[model samples]
Target chain A: MAKILVVDDSNFQRNQILRAIKDDGYEIFTAENGKIGFDLFEEHSPDCILTDLNMPELDGLGLLKLIREKNTDVPVIVLSSDTQELTAEKCKNLGATDFMNKPFKKDQLKAVLEKVFQ
Target chain B: MILTPDQEDAIKEFINIGAGHAAGALSELTESHVKLSIPAIKVVKLADLEKEDDSFTKEISSSVRINFKGFTDGTAALVFPPASALKLVSLVSDEEFGTPDMDSVQAGILTEIGNIILNHILGAIGNIFQQHLEYNVANYVEGEIIKLIEPDDSTPDLVIMIIDTQFNLKDLEITGDVVIFFKLGSLTKFVEAVENVLS
Candidate 1:
């Protein structure tokens, strides 16, 4: 089972994604903010990371940097509601595996993961 | 860094662009032909919050806040008084209703407004300043404005740029405010950007 780390400040958003993929048999670990998300990532070493862009203490970009320090190839997907191309571009330059806008469909997640695994 | 006269004018003009664009966007979204415009903008400490602002913040029942990070980082919040909140939801959703309340359903409806308003406002800022800021999902809460945007203990006092806007939705004279709280050092950076653009 592939393990996924989910990081976001909003519980509603976190639950929405988790519900979408919980039955896929992927083990999921969740964190409220980037600081704890990074700690959980270090502890769990999830196969991939799904994170929100903005948070207190440390943001998703900061967490992405921390992840890339030790593991360069982990698929980090940013799930954001912000439609700013600049933010998506920033994620790509920072080595993110994918960027999915909010209110995404189940098929969208599945497709991204399939590509990531392939 | 204290703002020079040129810096102040530039910032004001920058906000004018952002707010004007946002108002147009709002009109398009609601299909109500509403004219939303900012009548005044100010830089103030929380201690000096205007009386109407103080009362409005206290009376408002719902708010959506988005955090942004760039040359400056802070939260931009659009808080609506209960009457105005109800009006906004009805207008945006095109649902006829009376006595609006913040249930799970209505909150979802208002979140749409928040997303559009905040994103367009930020988009305008990003376009003008040539700064790409990372913004988060709108954090929605039902409470007083101050309680919802609780100050972290580390930064108890806030330096805010308040954009006081008049949103004339049909006959209802509702007001919404975009309160931007810039982080410690970012205020200086933002002013410098304004000065640079003017120069």
Candidate 2:
């Protein structure tokens, strides 16, 4: 089973993401902020990481920077409502495997995960 | 109106970029072509919101409101009148319109839409300022315009910036307003940040 870590500050968003991927058979772990998310990442070494861009304590960019410094192979998909080309470019420069905008469709998310694991 | 022409121009450009992204998000989510009209920016005292425009005072609307702090503090919302709100939810969701069960579904769908739209705009501001912002969870509310923008503890004398932009979607042209209010002292901080970016 693939382990995936999902990090976001909003409970509603976290629940929505959980509901979307729960039936896919991946072992899912969640955290409310990037700090907890990194802690989980270190402990479980999730196969994939999905995170929101704006968050308290540690934002997605900070988490991505932290993750990239230590591990290079794990796929980190950065999600945000900010769909600016510059935002995506920054994530790519920081070594994000992919960037997905928030309020994403369930099928779209699942397909991205499938692509990542494949 | 308090802003100099250069500052106003800069702010408009910033907001336009944000609205363009928001339009794209709305278009993809609704499977409709969304077009954004130019934004009209105004600074108004909290107590004078009703005097500023009929749209802000008389219209009964459904809105998803998000509050944020950091870099600046304020509220942002996606507001639609009742008919437009119903039309939008009907276009996007599987639920039949006017049904009893739709009340909850409408709130859910709109809240998510608001979350996406507001975040993109605020995210643009954050990026332009190179600062981090913390946002509260998005909330769905229904009321007249003043009720939509006023926080519980807002001082009546404080001034705010109101940016009103209209989004026209598909052939139906379901109109919605993207309203952002920068709280009292935050408007100055916001404009200063914009000027800093421009400089």
Stretches of candidate 1 exceeding 4 Å from the true structure? A1-85, A88-118, B1-5, B50-54, B153-156
Query: If candidate 1 were superposed on the true structure by all CA atoms, what would the RMSD be?
Result: 6.3
Displacement of the residue B105 alpha carbon in candidate 2, Å: 2.0
* Native-referenced Cα lDDT, model 1: 0.75
Q: Pick the candidate with the highest DockQ.
A: 2
- Candidate 2, residue A89: the lDDT equals 84
Provide the lDDT at B107 for model 1. 78
What is the docking quality class of candidate 1?
incorrect
Measured against the true structure, the TM-scores of the candidates, in listed sequence, are 0.63, 0.74
Candidate number achieving the greatest lDDT relative to the actual structure: 2
Q: State the displacement of the C-alpha of residue B186, model 1, in Å, after optimal TM-score superposition.
A: 2.4
The backbone clash count of each candidate, in order, is: 0, 0
Clashing pairs in 1: none
Model 2 DockQ vs. reference: 0.27
